[model samples]
Target: MAVAPLFGTVTLPSAHAQPEPPGEVVLSFPTVGVSPRLELGNNVASEVNLPLPAGMSAVRLRGVIRDQANLGAGFLEVTDDNGTFLGMVEIPPRSARPAPLPFDIDISGARPKGSSLPLQFLVRTNDIPADCGPAQQLVVTDLAAVYSGDEPSPVTIATFFPPVLQRVTVVAPTDADPSEQQAVLTLVSTLTRLYNPQPVQVRVISSPRGTAPPPTGPMARAVVVERGSAGLAVEEAGNPGAFLRVSGRGDELTAQISLLDNELQSLAQVTRARVDQSASHQLPTGDTLTFSQLNLEGRAGVLRRSTFNIGVDRAALGGGRIAGVGVNLLADYTPVAGGDAAALTVRAHDTVVYTAPLNASGRVDATFDVPSQALTQRVALDFEITYTPGQECGPLIAPMEFAVDPRSTLQLVRGGPPLGGFGALPSEFSPRFYVAMDGSGQEQLGHAAAVVAAVSRATSTPMTPQVVDVKAAAEADSGALIVANSVAVEQTSLNPPIGGNRSAIDVGLPQNLRADIADGLGSIQVFADPPRDRTVVLVTTTDAWTLVDPLFGYLDGLAGGWNDLRGDVLAAGAAGTPVDLTVRAGGSDPFEPPNVVEHRAPWLGIGIGIGLAVVAVCTATVGLLLWRRRRTDAAERP
Candidate 1:
């Protein structure tokens, strides 16, 4: 079944992006875009909570239905969160034969509660009797909610969360009181969970520290956390956390990091992004799973025998294997032989996949076809190389090496039915580091580290990003996270097609944001590598270094499901609020494709050194030292 799409303003290059019929917001639920048709009890209904911006006039529900006999009469009943009848669309009771078909449902009378709406749909016996064994197997996906109108942009709990907050100001009183400060930090932490959960170098601004008044753009949203800053001598109403929404365009919400600590279900409701968190190692098929920008050190060497291990996530196998499309492990190795007789063996989960005798000379590789059923949660691949010297007792050791190129890859070519949400991004299956920039300066490094940290936390693994230059990025085969200053962006030629130079834009705004500050924050834009189909490219800037903290805060601050980040670009500055982007005139300097795979090769360097030491111990220099020590001992012998 077509699944609900992951929400995010990701701008994919035409190559990797599937051309869907144009619509405002198209979601493939479960992320992998497939849901099995399970047995739905009599009158048992399924509820799908949709993130529909205001002006969502229609909803198209697509799914598959099956039974002992394909013909089954059933209609989907639709209702609002309040269970208020919103009307239902009738099915013609057609035979849902060979495939899962799509059907549209026109909802009326009830609209979204406020930007987000929950529609409970039930596909059951419309008129037929309930048959337990011969039940109507129904599966739904690819939920497309069409919206009209361009809403004003700004940061809000809704954006930071749901019920998107438009324009609002949150003031917390503080005067060096540790408890109050701690409370504020907690509040920021919760916001970070949604906005930029990564440590993006955010400077805590007390209510009175700034030279200019708190930012209040036409559509701006600011959170001021201080001890008793709200000046509420008495108890106040609304916004459950420790703080309240002082005032803004027209939002009445209260928040504080403590709310999350306190388990404020109300606030948690708005910030639903956290629920989408999952491990990073699991990958869905089709989309490539690789890290080309991870920073790592290597340990090289020569050895008589060596073993290289790799992990394979069985969950990514999608519960079943499909023909023609299975996991493929491509291993490329360069052999540095010291002996004439050498052999190599490779295995997957203890099952020997390939074996070949090393020519005792050059590089060789073997591609392994992995069966899905054979995979487990932590399957490992072991490559063993054995070498024998022509001489039985030789003092010299050959500098033999077999280095698996970083590009040596493991890819899932999924076949068969829809696997649901797996290898899609901004989610667990997505690659970390949409873009990685060169370590040009401390500021860049700091922000880059922060992103790596965030990805690590999100994936529950130590994250390392492969930093690449604009030139290398252009040739990169996998998706990446590219970061640079405005000047660097220009040099790399990854500038946005629309809008004047985003980095070089006139420091003009409704309020004089720059009048008092040196520079504010930064911005991140995600795009597809035009040359690489299905590959995503993220562009972040530190041209205005001073703005790095704010920019980082904005992007990582908002936790939009901790999964699919909605919108094309996410930018934050001195304003401290991250907003989705609208990019145009698509163009970028594709980085080098050599890309990244974060694996530490221990034998790449000193493998021969260890063996050489054994031979070196037999040398004249070693004999001299041994003789001198023995002579000295004899002279001192009592």
Candidate 2:
């Protein structure tokens, strides 16, 4: 057989023969939707054919080759349908083929989809592209029939391209309903082949009606885009899968089936009414009334005690015909002590509403049907009764209770005293007074005295007992035996010694006293009045002649201060005076001694005068005598 320059010019090993037996290239499908590859012994060549889908105008061929034996070398070059040269490559030899040599070529312009054409890979002797003139053609095959051609006789060898699977594109729902049995099975199977453990995501979609095969069961309502070979086979192999079963509410199903990128659990939402009320009302007597606002159903009742008057807030009373609101009075007002037990008539306005017994510790629920026709404004109830010691009053502390009906205005009369309960005394009526008396005997006791007297009279029915005493002083001079007495009266006047008793003559005595006896009389008066009760009297007697010898004996010291010298009685033994005839005639012994005024005065005067005269005479006489004697003595001395 003859050979032409093709494939690549084959290179011979420096240590080996010129021609090497033709090597085989095998192509196979590894993954759908993926480029196909060619298998060469222990090495893999990348996919040589990238099929363009139906409308695609271009295809790309790419692959890799391992020299394997260090001794073998070859060249690679491609040619189009017309046999025009396009591009070339040199496959270098390695000590051990180094590694795989990779190559890619644009086959788009060379061939279009659905076109049966011829393409060639020529292998030759040189490892360099330019050294290929003598190169031999390794293969020449039709591209469309590349998959299954028989052997040809020639000095060189060639083989058809290997078979690769076609990938089908489709759309499917990411979140397929679980009840879709067939759809679920088909999806699961396809994913299982592609991924060993089965991928978490699988698309199951519905095919269009009539345009594709009818599904066996319910068709998948959702679109399924399958990618793997098994998926395409399973899909294309059977009637396009069934529509998915709808579950529950379509809305709920749609919501649950809608896929989200993040993993989450499905949730639902749903609506419901509730009531609340509980409280206890404590009565003054230590009892409690408990009730619920919600459970009242229709109407309720309550009991109260003691006639202080139980007040109800008119606004809070619900609008309803209280069947005869009447108050019941319990004798002695003793509550039914421990548990709920007591009865009373409750009145709403004039109508007798409810008559129910109250529990000692519990409350009664009195309910009345309030008709639509009933008035719903302010209403009051008044109870009339005679004075009773104690009574259990209905709901009210007092007999009269003012309550307004429901939906009406409230009439509120303030409960207690207007003063808000404060008690205090004013200043004008406070307790206090003033008093006085006239001290001068003139009794000019003025308007002030009258006022005092009026006050005393007003405050007293009888006179209060009072005592008064007076001390009077007397003085007699020269010849008069008259007593000049100063009286100090003591009384409990506001101003004591000066007034009150001054004009009132409690007692009177002779205002004159004999000079000699006046002292004794003064002493008697002093002793007569007690010091704590009354003032004392003092009398002084005087005579005109007492001055005649007042300075005798150099005054003998003053009469009362330093010395106690007595003077001869004169003027009939008066304190100061000349001798009287009666006293002179009786002689000193019997007549109480006559005054020595004349002798005392003259003697003192004469003695003074004579002593002065004697001194003068003696002084002159001695001079005369001394003169004579000196004269005599001088004569004797000579």
Candidate 3:
């Protein structure tokens, strides 16, 4: 059985094939999502990027090949980020077709040479793209590794603690008719924010009566509102820490809001966390919120820094990378000669995409196009300002000051359509954030909450997921996350087109490619279908609820970002199975890949270099020649 990392749980591998040894760190996935239509012989290799487990040592790689077409005389080389040669595996001969070829032997020795963080694999062929047949494909179903190392807990305490923090469900009574959505959002928002702060999201559920609670055993959290017949009771998970609670008896939204407000105050009093009650300062979704809304100290004064999230719709761009988007900043500042430095910078994922010096005095208007590549579903804009004179300018009494108008704003130009579905995912708050769950199974709700928390962490937004049933899932107006067991999954009217005969509860796959999702494991997939123009992320497991619970950790929407999670479909293999996760990129259409492009910034830098290089060389040559002529004339005349 593959050992469970600190973050997720796993099942034992088939006795016949083992992905992880008895005790070893592992980052195993069912499929690396390498397209089968590999254009062989391009003399160029198609790269399959694989993610590495954290704090792993003495790594060894193993893979199972399901499909290989015309892969004649080609070799696969696995290299670390530094291109260090870890090892290589040769392809089989064409004349002799092999079924499920095995490359189980360790790639290198006990430890790879300079093992890097992320392992990048390059498959080089001695063939040409033009000569390669259309059916020439290479599909690797299972890629796993055994390593010697242990990582600290991957879970960070937020609303609850891990494994419970891993899954928390907010139970709101439906009889409350139009339940206090605002109050619900408030409670959800407060619970989702864990000060220790790891990008974790909490799933908020409003359930009808009679819903069975998740069976005991696995960790789970439930926050109930005591309204009408409802009552408040809390179960502490282990000895994690203390938490505040709110209780009241009323069904109206207003009453609920009051209750939630009280709850926030109680929680803040105990946790030392502040609740921004005057939400009048909270940033709005989309591009509407302005700089004035930022919670700056007494308008503008000493240095201050803050971060906020803005929701975006990538599907609007037809699921492709966007371009020509701009952010306008209106600032009013006064800069002292050299006394201190004041400026405004906008960063995306910690990289400064735009920065302007607070030069001169008065108002300054600047607009810069944020490269589409720099943006994600949950846009994080960091604002930093400093107006104090240099310590060196000390006591010299230089009237150096700076303050930005609340009118300082950000505008995302909608050049064409909306934008595009994110290549990166687990996106933050959108117009609508919904969690669709099939609560029939015991652990379904817990697994669903984990999924929602992952999204919240990824976007660093306090997501309040509107929990709905399977039927409502089909009709959600915006993006949703669906979590259910395999049987429950099949029950959902809207589901993967994997259906079998009326007598059977099996789903079919194209090209005879298959895996048993019902064999006691979980799988997750995201697609741009249903709700038209919105996305639906689905997570399902066979009967074993335990099997799917650990995946939320593997998704690591917090650390990995949506970088590794591309394509429309991803399947996590059953425990001890061949593949840990399988991804089918761009859905069925291999030509039009997912709407993500990595070729932007680096290429732009090269273009800029070339342009500057040409100008520099030309100008330098002319100047040198003119100087030489002048010197020659002077010497000849003398």
Best model per TM-score: 3
| lDDT tens digits, residue span 21-48, model 2 | 2332222223212223322211111124
Model 1 lDDT on a 0 to 1 scale:
0.39
TM-score of 3: 0.44
Encode model 3's per-residue lDDT on 1-638: one tens digit a residue: 12213322223234395454554754454222123222322233444433333334545666655666656656555555556566555655566646665554343333233323355555566665422123345666566655555432222122233311334455655543223333444455444444213232455554665343342222334455434433222334232322222234333332333323233333422222322222321224454445544332213433323233333333222222233456565655555456555666666557777776665565667766655545555344555554444554322343434444556555544332221222435432342456655654554554554554444434323444565566676676566777766665666555452322221223222222222223443456665553344556777655555545545655653344344554443333334221222122233222244442222111212221132121221234334434654655566694
lDDT of 1 by residue, 109-146 (tens): 44566545667766555544422123344554444443
Estimate the TM-score of every prediction: 0.31, 0.19, 0.44
For model 2, state the Cα shift of residue 487 in Å.
99
Model 1 steric clash total: 100
Between candidates 1 and 3, the TM-score winner: 3
Error of 2 at 102 (Å): 3.4
